[model samples]
Target: MNTQPDAPRHVVATSADADTVLRRLAREGWTARSGFALPDPAWDVAAHRIVLHGRIADDDTETVALAVLAAARGAGVVAVCDPESAAGRALIDDLSRIGAVHRGTDGADPVASLIPEQRALLDRLAAGDTIAAAAAAEFLSLRTANRRIAEARALFGVRTTREAVLAYLRQRQPE
Candidate 1:
């Protein structure tokens, strides 16, 4: 899990609401905590880079949630929402309405743009014709896709070359 130095700060109307958001986040691999001191007095929950005001539960809910989403966007934190919430549903709708395209063939964020170099590397890997070379490229990177490739290779017991890793990824991909 990517541990931010602090939880992104977000405002929620009540402590209960904050807890709800934090609990949901925990389910999705984000850790949350309260009672931290911030430059602003009303900033209660720090969940990534989001500062939340923890007092008004009536009107501030959506604002805080949106702020949290914005912070996630800014911080490169992929905010997975609880599917049960109206807010989550609305966010999903908004993403689709905007023609957002998600590609996770490399275990990277679907919302993020692929770096040109990485895209080139992924193309080779996906083709499976140059597996050894692609795996070599991923091995030298510090990015998460590289880490996932390494982890997937380890899980599949691939140590030979990128070709071997590509085969593993192909076998694992759904038919």
Candidate 2:
């Protein structure tokens, strides 16, 4: 037997009704003393491991979950729900797209690996520059700017440039 001490586990219950989800987690052996209720006053990203459960919908929820996952660093983060449910599947798809939880591919931090030029482009966009204006600032052709934005979107698994920028910023926030 390996005999290594088991790692600490952090759990977050996400649902329209957080209380209900939390209660369910409690029944599954996740006590408040052992885990945490997300969005609660005690919640912190520095926990050793995190397990998010319940339903996730809308951009706000996704954003928060992403932030938490980013804060967890390389520690394990698991989302539990009935995969057959539409909402659950959507959450899984979103998580997979963003590379939040491993799904065969290495879960690398997309924002951290951004090249200098890409970082500059993202900075300009965040500072309220239009794609054309940002490109002009960098002396890049409009086509090149568009390509860069597209690349960012693909890298972050976001559909729009705005979403990519927001995701990057959210991930960059301190825990």
Candidate 3:
């Protein structure tokens, strides 16, 4: 079991809003030892506990992807975003629905047969992008994205995007 005590150093991505939040938290005398890194290390299982609000530029999509990665690594990451903003609302909604990151590779990597589009779709979704948004990011129509998901589901032997996400992460494939 992880015996590391929670450090006062919370994780933050490179963004204006994130900077603002970090300032406030510093003033509040919380996470006084705050630190940062490129997304993967910052969100690693050994990294900080909470991923404060704002997009992670390191994620390429400028979304709260590092936060999702942290959560997937079982860090119990918490994100706070403006409910009025569409992106924030999506994070609030989607984060709640994602399951714990699973452990695979004890079997074949389920994502092995997936086409590049399917992999791209899951990557965006795992980064907290909505399906339509993920679709657009990959230059695919909503219909095509959904079709990719359906096809990927068969390849991964999963029923939903969420399931496919967990399966994909199970391999710890680089972000």
Indicate the TM-score of model 1: 0.25
lDDT of candidate 3 over 88-111, digit per residue (tens): 444433343333211121114445
The alpha-carbon root-mean-square deviation between model 1 and the true structure, to one decimal in Å, is 11.2
lDDT of all predictions, in order shown? 0.39, 0.51, 0.51
Worst window of 10 by summed lDDT in candidate 2: 4-13
- Show model 1 residue runs off by greater than 4 Å: 1-124, 128-171
Candidate 2 lDDT over residue span 22-77, tens digit each: 45445654433222134544434334333443333434355335534543332223
Determine the backbone clash count of candidate 3. Answer: 0
Per-model TM against the reference: 0.25, 0.39, 0.37
Q: Which 10-residue window in model 1 sums to the lowest lDDT?
A: 97-106
Clashes of each: 19, 0, 0
